[model samples]
Target: MTLQQWCFSYRGRLSRRDFWIWQGVWLVAMVMLFTLAGNNWLDTQMAAFCVVCLLWPASAVMVKRLHDRNKKGWWALLVILAWMLLAGNWTMFNGTWQWALGRFVPTLIFVMMLLDLGVFTGTAGENRFGSEARPVNYFGKPNYQ
Candidate 1:
């Protein structure tokens, strides 16, 4: 798996090791972007732009991680939907108890999905999405196997 394929493509599986490794990289990239931006409006905008630029790679990595679980790419949407529900309804958290359950459900969903994607190991072998991906080395050289 080359860096390009690992980051940009959605055709294969991502092992638990690669998923965590790339996730760490993603976290660092986000922190660096935001840190470099500081509090300047223009810089913040650029930092946000960089974050948006990472969206696809982030999505691809997550989707591939899901695929490794022997699940469909559509399963990835559950995470997105859960996140949207939680984030989109933040104001309602203080609105009323009636809306409390609404927030709780999505929060549960998000946490469950996070556990599923990040903690559990993928299926042992090839699945419908494709075979396991070879680990790529972005630090020194690209592994194309």
Candidate 2:
């Protein structure tokens, strides 16, 4: 997808290929943000802004990823709630081990969930979430019967 389309496109389900492409883009953006900002107050602020900017696309990707697993996108909302709790500790209160634990533990769980979703192929044929993501094609063209 084009950059603008990637930014704006949130409807329908995303295939595993789409999710990986978005992830690669996100990783590149993050690396650039860190390399440009370095260890400075500006870096801190920019990091926060970057996170805000990425939140929607990230959420959309996660939702679609879950959809690929035949789960409702609402489950991603719970992931957000967990993230808020984690971020709150870092932002509102001084960084504490408790806060780190709060963030890291739940995040580990979430990562595991993502691994499960990505590693296992979805059900063949249409599901409640959407049509089965075109047959693992590299180009993402739907293989018609």
Candidate 3:
């Protein structure tokens, strides 16, 4: 798939390599934006912009990666759920252990998702998603089988 389609649309399988590359690029862009914008209102605005502009592409990448794993796109929502849990700042219990539990649970989910999506190989060939993941050269050209 083309770069535009890869980032904007969500209808294909993506190899782990492409998922890693695109995710790394997106993270770098987010870090640069936040760093350059500084810790002020502009930073908040930039963060908002990143949410609106950058987040969807990241989601698309993850969705495609999930597809490659022969999983439903809904699996990608785990990342968001983990993030939300981590940010929840649970105070349900007065005990400090509650915080630890909350953090640990989400962190565990994150680790599991990371391993499933990044470490494990995708389904050997297309199962239900689409064609096999075409290997790409350094310059992004398809390396046909």
User: Can you rank all candidates by lDDT, best first?
Assistant: 3, 1, 2
Task: Estimate, for each residue in 1-145, the C-alpha lDDT of model 2 and write its tens digit.
Answer: 3444444555446667677777788889888788777856356786879878898888877776777677877777777666666665455445676666577767876787667555666666788876766423445565566
lDDT per residue, candidate 3, 95-140, as tens digits?
Answer: 6766666787788888998898899999986679888875434456
lDDT of 3: 0.80
lDDT of each: 0.79, 0.68, 0.80
**lDDT per residue as tens, model 1, 1-145:** 7788889999888888888888799989977777677745347777888888888998899889889898888888886777676666355446664255467777778788778888998888677888765676676574444
What residue runs in model 1 are displaced by over 4 Å at the alpha carbon? Answer: 89-103, 139-145
Question: Ten consecutive residues with minimal summed lDDT in candidate 2?
Answer: 1-10
Clashes of each: 0, 0, 0
Q: Note each model's CA RMSD in angstroms.
A: 3.0, 5.0, 2.8
Off by over 4 Å in 3: 39-43, 135-145
